[model samples]
Target: MGSDNTDRNKPGIANFAALKTAIVNGEDQLVRELLSHEPMLDIEKSYLIDLAQLNKNHTIIKLLENISVKK
Candidate 1:
């Protein structure tokens, strides 16, 4: 059987939780990695951006901004 990581494709509780965990834990590398993989987390959800803002995560905000610019 092939290993499946498709769940990572869809934005859900797990994805949101991972992102939130990265942010809350101040894991910059993890946060950047997650954002780079799924830019939609920021584009599709306004709350993520707001959360970044509230947390003063300039790097995350920049990642989101770059995504917006590319799209």
Candidate 2:
């Protein structure tokens, strides 16, 4: 039996949680990597922005803003 694993490989809560951690920790590269692979919803983006703001992460905030604007 053959089955595609693409769906299984899709980012889920763990990725989201990791994104949150990356944002809070000011890990730009990790954040970029996660964002590149995961399609975040508007609510998720907003929440990430809020988290970035809380941490005063201008870099992450700008990154999120740029991506949000592009999409």
Candidate 3:
């Protein structure tokens, strides 16, 4: 039988709202922790990058970029 990797990769957050909040508020550590916990789709990563760009958070933007690349 095949193992269920999909569930294992699920994000810890209940929803995107929390992540959006963290990104909008410039919470780099929280963002890092959240992102490290799981994987996100390319579109989701793009949206997060946009939000980080809007807030001018280069650190978070870079983090997102790195994660996106790794994924």
Candidate 4:
């Protein structure tokens, strides 16, 4: 795991990049892992939803929707 101080200073763009790569690569496990590690990483305004739509990944969309509902 990254150091707490380092992780806190990490830019949100880095998290967005990782999330985009994970979604595009169809690495659902990686997506979950990234989300788990960066629970504070914001996804609502990211391109993740657009990627899921472009790829017709209904499962991911549903998962995102479920998460949004919970929040």
The lDDT per prediction is 0.66, 0.80, 0.79, 0.63
lDDT of 4: 0.63
Q: 1-71 in candidate 3: lDDT tens per residue?
A: 23466565454445567778999999999887777645678888898899999999999999888864325
Error of 1 at 42 (Å): 6.6
TM-score of each: 0.58, 0.72, 0.70, 0.58
> What lDDT is reached at residue 52 by model 3?
98
User: Runs in model 2 with CA error above 4 Å?
Assistant: 1-10, 37-39, 69-71
Q: 1-71, model 2: which lDDT tens digit per residue? A: 13346556455767888989999889999988887643557877788999999999899998887664225
Can you give the lDDT of residue 45 in candidate 4? 32
Off by over 4 Å in 4: 1-11, 36-46, 69-71
Query: How many steric clashes does model 4 contain?
Result: 0
Best-matching candidate per TM-score: 2
Model 3 alpha-carbon miss at residue 67, Å:
1.3
Q: What lDDT is reached at residue 34 by model 4?
A: 61
Top candidate on lDDT is 2
Model 3 scores a C-alpha lDDT of: 0.79
TM-score of 1: 0.58
Give the C-alpha miss distance for residue 22 in model 3, angstroms. Answer: 0.5
* Over 4 Å off, model 3: 1-15, 69-71
lDDT of 4 at 12: 62
What's the true lDDT of residue 62 in model 2? 87
Structural RMSD, model 4: 5.1
Query: Ten residues in a row with the worst lDDT in model 4?
Result: 36-45
